[model samples]
Target: MANARVDRLRMMLAREGLDAVVLSHPHDVRYATGYHSILERWTQMEPFAAAIVFADPARPAILVIPEANLGIVAVLNRDGPHCTFDEIRSFDMLNFCEVSRYVDPDRNGGQLAEDAMAIAGAIRGTCQPDIAAAITAALADHGMAGKRIGFDEHRVSAAVAPKVPHDYRDALDFMMRVRVVKTGEEIERYRAVGRMADRVIAHAGSLLHEGADWNGVQAGICDFMVRNGVIPVDEGAMLFGGSYDGDDFIPDLFRTPGKRALRRGDIVILETQGVLDGFWIDINRTAVIGRPSADYQRLHDILRDAFLMMVDRLRPGVSTNSLPAIGYEHLKAKGVPAPEKLLVVAHGIGLMPLEIPLAYPAAGLAGVKQGFVMEEDMLISLDSLFFGAKLGPCHMENVYAITAGAPEPMYAAPLELIVADHAPADRASEPA
Candidate 1:
């Protein structure tokens, strides 16, 4: 299945008129070659591995890794279904030293040698060349170094840019487009994320009420997520939009939790979004403190129906531009008001959470527009919200895997408005 994924990427590269690509972005690297780097720890200075993905299926792919990580192959088992790369180029910092050029106390002080291995046995130091240089050199050796190469522009080190020609294009978007569809192993990883989301969302529900601080709820949710091994990412945030408390539209749907306290009858919207391994779980849950508004309850029903209606129409040939209106019209026909800048009701979520082919409400939608077709095995996240007066502006966001039959839920939380226990936390005066 992983090979099938890489094969798809190769096909895309061929279509784009590129011969080869160097993938160093952790997500793209893992997607192209099933070698999972440290989860949520992707940095510019990666010391472990990188992969050179080729556009031709018959041609073998290449991999560059630090020598220390060579032993990791025993556990990772890249020789089998995990990856398709055949050539392995290992770099050893220990080889960088001229031990004989230095003075050795034990050997009559002639030119002495001290490399990484020798230093580990005695001294310590840092190496100069990065993995990018080796990547550039490998591409050059293959005779495609000056051709239009596809590489992660952000990961291309200053040492490598000069080596690679000006024609090199950014490959992150193309790679992500290829990764929109999840393989069997990738879906299984998301299943684990589904489990984590259920527990974490339930935990957050128990702590909501008047006087419950936004930050406090965030802290409790973090503890639950961490306990379940769903380590959090700083860039990826858990949000709570105090929509009803404030007047007008909630300008930012991703408003982070803070010192603001929950008021009586305020609509509490919690979005549990995080990545597990490379898969993702993006869930939206809406609840109320005390009594609920009839309009809010009605809006929830309309949103729910609209969401289901869109899911029902999702098939291989369905147009991406057709989705948003399907959802938006359902809400509007049912008397639910559409909020300002209501866009991207649905999007593909896999490697980076928001992939492409976003569905817009109007004709001139500004995303991956009309002609793009939905395919089998594409993972999507639907975000539906209603911003009206009093209580919520209800929202329901969930991740689903598009199947030949019906879309499979990554994790199914309660769709109804959760009426929590009337217990208040700390102290607060309700807004007059």
Candidate 2:
């Protein structure tokens, strides 16, 4: 299959007048070359892989990786359509195999010999002493020497500037602009991960009991996600429940989960985040232990209705800056106390949790204005949170794919407050 993501990067580079882009960010490399380095999980300061994309459509993108990963890249290309690099180059890092010795065809005939030959071919004339030298050589070979090249990371740009003769510029904002829209494959991966996270959050609701604590719920969520082929992001899951500081009830959403046990009628907010392939899954749901009070129910109903209204308004050409106003007006009309406290944020979500058009504000980010219009095939998460001092807190977050007609919810979870009852009599005796 053709890689549409690389094509998009090339188009963006051409439009911006950049000759080529050298990307060292782990997520940027994966999005460009479809290669995920194991070293990315260990360190971010030292990049073990890089991707070089030229503005010219004819010049194929190159993937510069460590020599240790050549075997896995060969295997992935042989077994499936995982790796999407047009050319593979390597640099000497931690070597995994002895390059001097050849695999005996007689002893390892079928797959081993084939893989060995592929690895040898990949590293034959492309391996360099280090990442800077490897990228410099690739740029020179591709006629990009002394050209206007964009670097995604500032540190990588500074390190490579001394070695390569090129006009380097920062391209972090350029990269975000290219990644705002999702391709067909990326959308499919998002949907798949969204379905998995929905199931995981539902499992979390089942674990709610009188004695259930945040740590236990988080542990269960992690175990469940690992068993189901999704990698948990960060703390696996975040569990926040309502509590009373003194005579007044303080609804704090930012409190870290501890050993405090969950009690009946306490509102709980559960957010599940995971990754499948290269896409991220972030969805949140709120539930109450046993029955909810009338005040809590009314508050949740108003929030849910407001959430639905905003989601329905998501379509092509709708300004994202206007979404918060729409939500605020609806909440105020419904007599929601402190409607200004309701935060409505809409932003793209794919390779990362927060992508451009950033929901929150920053000092200097070009092309990331607040009133940007939503486009088709843009995967976004609409997050709404309201913390009331008396009624506790309520949050509703969901991922949606902007389409031609109506926005499609990536998961099958309902947008109502979950009323989690006590554990069954038979299962209550078992350990959590």
Candidate 3:
């Protein structure tokens, strides 16, 4: 699996015109080498460490990983070269001579240990003061006094002393420039996750009722994701009732479901999660208790059409900004609201649920010249949501790959509203 990923990384290196690239970021490291923690003790102390990738157009790929992670590296590359291993205990500048062979292939011996020292210093300060002290000595021994290297500005702290010069790029950009686009195997795994989410959501929808509480719904969906092969231990799903009705309600950043039972005329927004190989697919669907009003139905129709129209615009050469514009025109032509003002277009989705190359627009985002260029293999989400003042919440969601032609929806669950028939026994006096 990682052999293919390494090949893609080499291609990226060639495109970027970089001689060799080092990956100390956990996500980047995983993308390149598929090395996860077998050394739980050291991982807890320094969970964010990774190996450097030195790509030479002429030679084979070389990776520098921790000695404890050798097993993972071995499994990741059963058919490829055993990646070079560096012991974490002696990770300072003094012991970096071994890495020089991989880093500076032309040099006979001498340590260009600036990056290792900087990485050691950064991880040392996290929770383990003892490790911090040890890595401080490593930097001094390595002679990484002055060198230009790229680091994640978003992650690297202000307190850490700068041992080397750094290039500032948004951490999202650095990662997505390499990862936003998926490989054939990655897309297959992603499709599997989406199918799992679709089945789980469908099962949850079938078991719904007017008396069902938020916990009941969440329990069913959670079990389904786990049974159908999704990483079950994430933050899980959020069930919104009538409490968060306004535009100010940011949906579920950190809110859990309440004791509110399903009632007649209530719209239930189900945002279930699916994970395959650490990549994520978030698909949200709205289920209505009893049939909805004509006005609510109208909004759902408009949003559905708009969602398809926006997704149809994705291709290899189109701009990310064009998505929101097309969605706006789509809704406007149908006599609905604008996409930007309504916030109902597509967005980026990947390992973190939301990646960069966002499909939406913002002020000063025009001419930013960033985001998905609709390149082949880029995985993104096309989600259209409607928050009605007269009704409740509605969402149509799917994952898409930017191909040479049209965008492909990874998950193909029903796009329209799923209506449930039941009367609210406790709210007989309430008006619809």
The candidate scoring highest on TM-score is 2
Residue pairs that clash (backbone atoms under 3 angstroms), model 1: 99-112, 99-113, 99-114, 100-111, 102-112
Q: Where is model 2 poorest over a 10-residue stretch in terms of lDDT? A: 359-368
Candidate with top lDDT is 2
Query: For every model shown, what is its TM-score relative to the native structure?
Result: 0.76, 0.90, 0.69
> What is candidate 1's lDDT per residue for 80-178, written digit by digit as tens?
445435666555544533342365567642222222232133111222254666676776666664577777655573446676563667776677667
Candidate 1 — which residues are off by over 4 angstroms? 36-49, 68-85, 91-128, 143-148, 154-169, 235-237, 243-252, 337-344, 357-365, 368-371, 422-432
Q: Pairing residues by index, what is the TM-score of model 2?
A: 0.90
TM-score of 1: 0.76
Candidate 1 positional error at 218, Å: 0.6
Positional deviation of 355 in candidate 2, in angstroms?
Answer: 0.7
Tell me the tens digit of each residue's lDDT in model 2 across 1-432. 368999888888889999999999988888988888567889757788999888887877788887767666766677677877767677877554345345565674567557746655644246687887788778777777679999987776676667577888888878877888888888887878887877877887777776676567777877877778777775635534344454332345654545477777767787777777777778888888889999889999999988889999889999777778777898799888888888777878888877765433432342233656899999878888886556778898999999998999997898888887767442222222
Candidate 1, residue 374: how far the Cα is off, in Å:
1.2
Q: Global CA lDDT of candidate 2, please?
A: 0.76
Give Cα-based local distance difference scores for all models.
0.64, 0.76, 0.55
- How many steric overlaps does candidate 3 have? 3
Which scores greater on lDDT, model 1 or model 2?
A: 2
The window of 10 residues in a row where model 1 has the poorest summed lDDT is 119-128
Error of 3 at 29 (Å): 1.2
